[model samples]
Target: MLDFFTIFSKGGIVLWYFQGTSQIFTQSVNSLIKSVILQERTGSNQFTHEALTLKYKLDNEFELIYVVAYQKILQLSYVDKFLDAIQLEFRNKYKDDLQNSALSSNFDFRQDFDRILFEVEHAAKKQIQKGKVMKSFEESEKSKKSVKSMIENKKEEPPKKSGKGKENKPVKKTPVKEQEVKKTSSVPMATSNTSNGELDEETIRKNRERLFGPAKKKKSAADVSKSPKSPDNNKKRVKVGTKWVLGGTSEDAKELDYTDGTADNLDVNGVGVSLKDEELDYVGRMKGELRDVETESESEEEEEEETVTQKTSSKKSSGGMFSMFKNLVGSKMLTEEDVAPVLDKFREHLVSKNVAADIALKLCESVSAKLEGKVLGTFSSINSTVKTALTESLVQILSPRRRVDILRDAMDSKQKKQPYCITFCGVNGVGKSTNLAKICFWLIENGFRVLIAACDTFRAGAVEQLRTHTRKLNALHPAERHGGQQMVQLYEKGYGKDAAGIAMEAINFARDCHIDIVLVDTAGRMQDNEPLMRALAKLIKVNQPDLVLFVGEALVGNEAVDQLTKFNQALADHSNMTNPRLIDGIILTKFDTIDDKVGAAISMTYTTGQPIVFVGTGQTYTDLRNLNAKAVVHALLK
Candidate 1:
């Protein structure tokens, strides 16, 4: 049974919904399904949420149609058929209403859909039951047929005949007419014998030969032993005019006399017949024809070579003229009209790669500004020129303005007798705790003391997760260290406590212990959650971390832009400072999953004006890699 079903307009407005389960659960499911559909719409049209067993479909008009089930259902065909029927009926009934936007408020579908809902439900139930029965019956029939075939084969094996002086008589073959009559009869036939109650191989062979035609004859031993004719015996040698003629000793050979040499002038029906003397004449003519062919081929080759040289020279002259013109102008400039077409294509490409439409437009505009009146020297074509401009622009935007040197900053803080506090924040499932652990590992590997502050009191296992990471990292002590094994310390105030207060306490403890850096792990919060955002802003305001880096997934595309923007705004507003605390840098997670849709990294950085310091390539601690602008641009373009 369907747990929930929903219909959405092309613009993602929910037009109708029916829930057969808890309202809260259905709402959550609907939100998740909407997010999945939105993401799919950017790249694909259909996707399945395996966790919820929800199936979604988008019609030709871009209307979203979806259904949810309690568990995995094998008979999905019924659901598809039902959805098609509903969509057709709705479109047919509300053809004018759907087209006119002003009619949406007045249109009521509740009463009209009752019949359709009932019919679809009944039809789906009957189809599902019918499918199950047919599947079971087919299995039973297959098993029965297999068992009967095996028993029949065992019973058909003839028993060995006893060796006796009396020979067994051949089985009598049934007439074709009687065989047809027996086949039409209802009585069961015995498997041990034919209709005549006897089994014989000779009789079977004779009957088969009678029904079909006779076979080919086999070769005799004498015919197979005969040898082929020798070359010397097949021809007679005769000398004529300084050449010897090998003439065949057959009826066709008697027409020619080899000794006279008259065969040279002989024309057999205007076709050249080569005799001993005519062979020389034929050779001479062949040599003349070969020479003509060689001359023609050589002339053709020379002409092709000349054409290639002319083309190369023409290209060089054109290139030189262009270079001279640039030198005269004092610089190569890209006019607005020159790159409009190329920029349009590039914008489309970015959008097709799942980059946000607005961001893509802005990126194109930025590229256009950067390219206009810019020097172009030795560039090949408009395509390469635009590519170079875009690559440089992306690299400029992606390059971090403020360098993130964690070890250097921590060391400087250590020398000053204070712990450098760094806080990690982002929405849920962006790997906040995991990335904090990775940074901790990096600091320790560089021979610096690290402390993990478990200030994420909201999540149930947030503190435990930090403790696990600390335990695993503490085990990997560098062998070159002169002192005892360096271990990471975790400070947790347990769940349901003031997170900002705990972070402040952890900072004080780190200062007392002379720790190099204190990595604060904040609870994952959604950007749209005002309460949580305000709480996060309070934590940041109270603690005032040296580095507040935003961690986001690279597969979220433009949504990451919205998230970072809202997060930055919240922090700026609630921090209660004249100049709001800004995100120092971004740490993008899941960089390996989104193969072609990697524009998220560029979009996030370009939108926030923040650099991506490190990208999490995999789940392991060692999977983190320093971000390079060229490498990122290459991956995106590739």
Candidate 2:
């Protein structure tokens, strides 16, 4: 026991300490055991230990605790009578209710003695009553014993002597000689049967017959019982009744392969799977596994379904379609008044621009549907395919009309003296250069003299990539490279030493060369930086470009909108650009790669009232699609 305690104490999971009075509440079994051994061995009372105690065994095995050396502590059992002694000693002890109650009620000696006595007394009374009931039974048993005793006494009495025995005793010995002669005569007759006499001939004939003919068939117990071995050859066959079998039908059973390598018989709902025996075995195992998988999947589906049903049911109980529809449409914070005028103006513009009203209404409905799953319902259980289709329908309706309005306004507000020059100026990787290249190809295809300015000189590949792109589209590309001093001088003429100067040079070159649309692509800049944004401001000041299209990536999420907002703020300092929200329009690049384009579309709406003018759907130059809102919605939803 001491060795067990020592080993257990070193295991680190056990906590040990001593407690007589002072540390009674803090004491534990593990601690008390350790303390006793330590005090005896060390001859010093300076050990303290604590065990990680639990109400139940932790991890199904060892109890956890912490034991450390401390000052002398008294033994717990030595604590004597005092007011609140029990309460203080057992304050945090492992005192189970039943054990504590039994101890306090004095169950150890008195209750056990009383309980045993009660049981013994009750048993003694029952035994006494049983003895009383059998008293009458003893008398009958005694009478039977007496009758047997009388019979035994008569049996022990001597037999009476025969009176005529004395007369017969005289002739008894004289008959011995006569008896011997009779025995000798009987012996010869007994021997005659074995000596092949008349009886022997009859026995020999029977033995020969038994060994040869007159053979009898050996019978089995089953034959005696008359049980048959095999079914009758002419008996009709019955169908095997199993889950996979069809009821009273001539058609063969269909085997199905399931997800888990188990196959099961699946009832045919439509077309049946025809398989060979080997394939059927393989499918049977697969179907069994699939059933397990489907069962789990169904459980999960049921949980999700219940959640949706509960939410829908609760909402339905609260109100009907109008209330539900109101909540659905109500997600858009713009009230009817705020949106109605916009819709009216949108309708008039679409009509003026030759857009069908049916297309416009579909766009509105689809937009509403997109918001339905997100804002109206507690559950996100909308069908993915249905939602995608609805979204596509909306984009198809809105994109073209919005594009027409933007392009028409840009054309109408054109500067007669100045050449049409637009630059996609923003931060790096914002799709600025890519959008410029795409729009240049667009303008060139539209019968315009388009010139692409490769003003992003920080990376050598930037100019090469733009030039390569222009070469593929058969459009003109203008570029230049300058060192720090010459770059500074160019910006002193009213733009920055960096992108601003390059953009200014590109704009002037386009004007002199009579390029209809000089699209200057700048290095991506952090729009949030006042210095970088001011540089863009300086470029616009010097070049006074007709349009400044913010080229944002379709995958840019809402960050593009944030940059657009700050860029507009800095651009306001420029006197040359009238709407320094020079966000004349937007070109959402890489539209093909985005799974959901609604975020990008809504971003454009929130940041710039301007619509997305163009989209780059693929890597090729001809992959650019004119951003018709309806087309974007249609393509994304589809």
Candidate 3:
């Protein structure tokens, strides 16, 4: 039995829904929309959330999605057929409403739904019964006559003659030897007769000459390989030598210049400050390109304009189902052959943009599966339709499951007198600390006090780096402005301390100090480092930050998937929880460096099913930006 059925528009408008149970399915439906539909993962037909399993069908032309949810334990066999039948019936009944997306909430299809469901279930049951039913007596018979009549009519073939081997055995021929070869094989053998069937004197001489290489063409490899060079073949051996003697050069100090008073260069009286070991090992702040700062008004205007263009494009693309492919001359169904070429080219485009090869292949397969056997409109082309679908899919991939409002969340945490903790972790040199500072700066810019925990105790100058960033951020918003409370502060216990304990202590310190957010900077380690991974897992499990952001580089291609996958696996394994906590989100650093090769974004998102929480586009504190799914996809395809 179905627990829920719903039809919704791509723009988040629910047209009609049927609920068969009192249990609220809002969370399940929302999750389906967020984790599956919005993620452009329609490539998969089924989604499992807790106890329910959801199956969905997408109507690209109508920009609609039909979903059905049921208990996972039930082995419902008719969901697919039922979905297809309902889709047809609904489309036929409300073709105009769907085409226009009007009366979306005004449709009444309870009767149609119930009738279709019942018919589907009945057909399924009948199919099962038919398979189990036994055949009648006459139906199982090869002959329709009575047993006595069949016995009388039955006949056997007469035995064949036993003298076959004695008289009719095939006569084996002694092969005709060269006589047949001369007649069949066109390639003249070296010792075979000429066209006259005889080896003449002139032919023999010519054959002998041809057997070896021509004199002018140089000796044959066989001759050279078998014959060694003799002394007479070489000119007089001339030994040419210039600066070297047969014997080694004499060991002498004649050219030595150590006689000069080297003590004249040394001055013991000159005094200077002695640098400490820490000073000698200090690393200066990193530098890179920064994103151009955008004014609040300008950003809002751009967002509004982008939204308008997107809406217009979507409306134009699928306003009327038939209008889509109207330019294709006539309506025709798509086959594997029709879309294969386009999907191949699309896959190459994704790969060139640094998408993983396997991921690209699968994406092409998904597109092919969706387009196969589907009718194209008279107005469209295969390339264009495939591109449109691919674009939509990519946009869904980049779209986050939820609107991540860090500022709002931090504000809430501040109200509750608890620090909002965001921990940054990733492979080494991925700009984790830098991006942490960028986020910290953003938090401070919004008037919230931030504490950066230097939990990267393994690496030298890790604490100092955060300290420098804290100072810079505080300078940008000095303490004189917020009642003498510094906007940004760094909490550190120096190097060689337990990172996990440091993080826990930092959180409590922030809570006590009234800090709005604590950005914990964990040491970067390769995904394969078990000890470090265990340490990282312990930090997350112990402190349990509100958000665990994995920092990854955008420049990576196929390695992106492996790195993120391993990191997540390590966390889950090391955390040792029944439902272990994996990477909650991603911080994609060096976004600007990747150009159009934005496939790492897709790889990371696909691997973890998490969002790109922040993209570090530049070096400055203000260079961070939220991912724009459409813009990213556009760049990717381009």
Top candidate, metric TM-score: 3
Candidate number of the best lDDT:
3
Task: Name the regions of candidate 1 deviating beyond 4 angstroms.
Answer: 1-334, 373-380, 478-482
Residue 255, candidate 1: alpha-carbon lDDT? 68
Tens-digit lDDT string for candidate 3 (589-615): 898777677889888888788888888
lDDT to native, each model: 0.68, 0.46, 0.78
Off by over 4 Å in 2: 1-417, 475-498, 573-581, 631-638
**In model 3, which regions exceed 4 Å deviation?**
1-26, 61-64, 89-337, 361-379, 415-417, 441-449, 464-488, 528-531, 566-582, 618-630
RMSD of 3: 14.0
lDDT by residue (100-148, candidate 1, tens digit) is 7533454466665567667777877787688776456656766667665
TM-score of each prediction: 0.48, 0.35, 0.60
Residue 606 lDDT (model 2): 39
For lDDT, candidate 2 versus 3, the one ahead is 3
Please provide, for model 2 over 121-148, each residue's C-alpha lDDT reduced to its tens digit, 9 standing for 90 to 100: 5665676678778556556766656565
